[model samples]
Target chain A: MSSSTQTAQYNPAYHRFTLFLAICTFLLIVAGALVTSNDAGLAVPDWPTSFGSLYRIPPMVGGIKYEHGHRMLAEFVGLLTIILAVWTQRKEARSWMRKLGWFMLLLVIIQGLLGGLTVKMRLPWYVSTAHAMVAQTFFSLTILMTVFASRRWIGSTVTLTRHPDPGALSFRNLALLTVLAVYMQLFFGAGFRHGGLHFFPHVVGAGIATVILVWASFSGILRFGNIKPIRGASIAILGLLVIQLLLGFGAYMTRVVWGKDAVQPRPSMVATTVAHVAVGALLLAHCFMLAVQAYRNLAPAAELSPADQKAVVA
Target chain B: MKFRFGLLLILLVAGCSKNETPPASYKPEAPTAKIDPSTTATVSGVVTYTGDVPKAQPIDMSQDPACVLGKVPPNFGEAYAINKGRAANVYVYIKDGLGNYSYPTPPPATLDQKGCRYVPHVLGLMVGQKLRILNSDPAMHNIHSMAHENDGWNESQYPGGDAIEKTFNKPELMIPVQCNNHPWMKMYVNVLSNPFFAVTDAEGKYTISGLPPGTYTLGFVHEKMGEKTLKITVGAKEHAVAGPAFSSADIK
Candidate 1:
């Protein structure tokens, strides 16, 4: 196969790996839910240890189940990403792909350390929340890697007229704004997840950010008709926003639906918190998609001259 | 290939070192309390409330630099009663002269957060034993307990979460427990060598039972209220009443 064709080939392993990662991410999130649901934040008091003993598995107690389960899932994911990175290095010739593999490896290690620190430091809210944020980012980056590796996500050359379109900047701005807004929203969401509702402001701030995300999605969809994917992503974001909003309310109100008061949070909080995290992951993915779309539209391609290709090699 | 193989073998051997067990014949002493049993028996008391405690101030943990600007609730490190206008959640125990009875291995204990407050405002547990910390809220809460002896451990838990199980390797007198998430949520954990400690009731009364018929020093520890000590004699069959008249100011 020609280099271009070979590069373009639909690698089944890439798809399989992406799917595997997706499933694993889902399971990991569920494991996180179990951890939270079981109230097992500090089952292992020492970071990376159960009762100060390094080798002893944390007993399958309520908190231990969650905390240790989280640790185990993290290790599983770490190994998976290491394998994925190694596979990419072995099979991929692209420098970007190689760099991405290395980056993924670094991120997985950092993520693992962060998990340990969260335990060692007794799960400080900020560190704990940042730990969650990095996990979502890791998930998004892996998805991006999969996208780049897939045949459909081609870095295609596009022709545009010299006359600039008036709506181009708006689209660019909207894309950038969406990324920033979604990230900020996720940060606040992390605060909410880690703040323990003792701080009323964080609670209110998260609610406000959710509201803005909903509004931004609606407005972006209505205004950006030229960018189909942008509009689609916006609409999808809107839907997730609604679900998250309802999840929050359901978490708050449905205690009575389960024969409890509104003030009491239910097991649904675990699922809702996880879903909230997952949606944030999706938003980051969409942001990456928009960035790629924008970059592709603007970059000029000359079929990489032989000299450029040689330079890439060196 | 030989180098890599040799390195892997070395790593495997290194990992195997973790599995070595200690000599089985070596017997260890019973998990005893931190206090010297021979010293004057020091008495320590903790008062506990079964009802809700009113927040002296509103604690808000809404923004970054968590709890920086927010008002430190009156109970930041202090304990008080909420309903019935009675002081509850007080502690009075024997701190010195514990020479006769060694502190037992702390039995498994649970510190549950139900309705935004620690279920038992004052928890009594042994050194080197596990104590389960449970969070029943739907909100994220950070449990920051400042222990003088044990390495201070802090942790954040999501709601409907399981307990944060922890063990203090060393004995601690009175570690203040605070929720950094909720400045108002505060409690105390008293780590002792013996279970002879008792928390005071709403009536401002406390009692230490199971004394081994000897003279010992007694002490009381209350958050913000400080600690108190007195010498007392424990008879095998005599029931002893500590106090209802001790003032918070006096303890401080």
Candidate 2:
């Protein structure tokens, strides 16, 4: 009964570390985008090492800069994930969250191996595309952790118990659906990038994703726009999606259309395409946060907020 | 649902199975031309502009943050640059009316991106002459050519990247080169078949040599002002300076 009564305590250090991991994930996603944009996936042409050395000797310029730089950043994030997992295992009170920490550490390690395997295997379409998908997932997971560790989320129960707002199923359902739609689009994007002949489908999928995401974001905003956290997440999701749409169109023109005749170092093409790909990670993270917020707000028939109990008892 | 997803994965892999392979032993033909040295004359002149000179406006490099990796490029907008009563960046060449007298193509010309701006804002090359593009800045530079006559190409070169080797197969008067990454970065390249072209410098002076002694129509092209064609004769061993200062009134 005491365990049931005890509210989740806010841990500022854990929250800060979770935020750091989220930022790192975002940077890693951007770095990965640069590698693909510069066509530098094979620039280093070696795995787990640059040019067969631990140190990038003689210093590579151009494409290799992006490739090697991405590797270094990813490794740093991988180390950070391990440290976070160990800390969470030791200090975190929630059993499910602790397991999640360990699972995320496992995901980061697998992601690291995929990064190396992608390079060593000469960027096979399957492996490379999977690597990109995993990156989005890992980034989303980091965002989930960031949301779960937030001051707002830790004090969520108190707000729900006092405010007694209706648990709108529309927002919750839309949030869950948005996550699935985003993952599907990311898979298509990965295949499209690798020339997996999924470009046509990917383009169509983008159109569908735009509609679904807009609807979902609108639904959330309509239902719980009064709440600060929900409003912020909803607006961010919509804004990032709009940016992603513009970048996607720009990328298509420069890369898919002008790509055939383009000379080396096509500047505008790379930037637009990279932004398009990287924004997906941001959108995915936002969607996952929206889902977590929805879950926090909507619970039916069991373990109702104290305010809900008050209504029932009266 | 799981089975369908697995099938889609297999379909994706199979669809991407097609691999690209370069053509074997593919090489473009070498360029060759015969220059008639007999009775050849030179054309020289000062390209003065009669208009209000537009001052150089500072270029906004806000789009590409890395443009300032080295030294920042000075202001752009050289549409009409005049100093001491002389026009710079005036393009002059023999537009037409030369009969079948071919000249050997010169060596490749160089266009460098030093401070996120192309050094020598305008350059000329023989149709088959190579263009060596280098990125001297620490940021990335891409060359996107919008040419109506020659084949258009877009190339990317990171800082310290290998020099790009490119060539034009047809005569194009002015090919607009765009740096797509840094939208403001732009340069013009002129490709002609004959080696009878020159752009004016700070003093607004240019000389066209290796011209066969004959009457030919000389053309002047300015970036913003307009273009002009004037009939001129290259008398035997004559150094015909272009007469009549080019004024903005003549610009359409």
Which model scores highest in DockQ? 1
How far off is residue B105 in model 1, in Å? 19
RMSD of 2: 10.6
| Cα error, candidate 2, residue B205 (Å) | 41
Estimated TM-score per prediction? 0.57, 0.55
Give me the runs in candidate 1 sitting further than 4 Å from their true place.
Answer: A1-6, A46-59, A155-169, A196-220, A251-266, A297-314, B1-89, B92-150, B153-187, B190-198, B201-204, B207-252
* Candidate 2 ranges beyond 4 A from true positions: A1-8, A55-58, A162-170, A301-314, B1-252
Judge candidate 2 against the unseen true structure and give its global Cα lDDT, from 0 to 1: 0.74
- TM-score between model 2 and native: 0.55
Q: Which one is best on lDDT?
A: 2
Residues B1-252, candidate 1: write the lDDT tens digits: 366346434543533442353312313355444443343332323333333343443322232232243335432323454234335566666677555356557568888875556778887776656888887654456687866566665676766776678876655777877664343466788866567777766655566665665676676665655665667775556555444333434432
Q: How does each model score on lDDT?
A: 0.58, 0.74
Q: Per-residue CA lDDT of candidate 2, range B98-214, in tens?
A: 766546669889999877778777889887888999998877766777676665555667679999998887777768886645545667898777788999888898888878788
What is the C-alpha lDDT profile of model 1 across A216-253, one tens digit per residue? 56655654434554566677777766776676555444
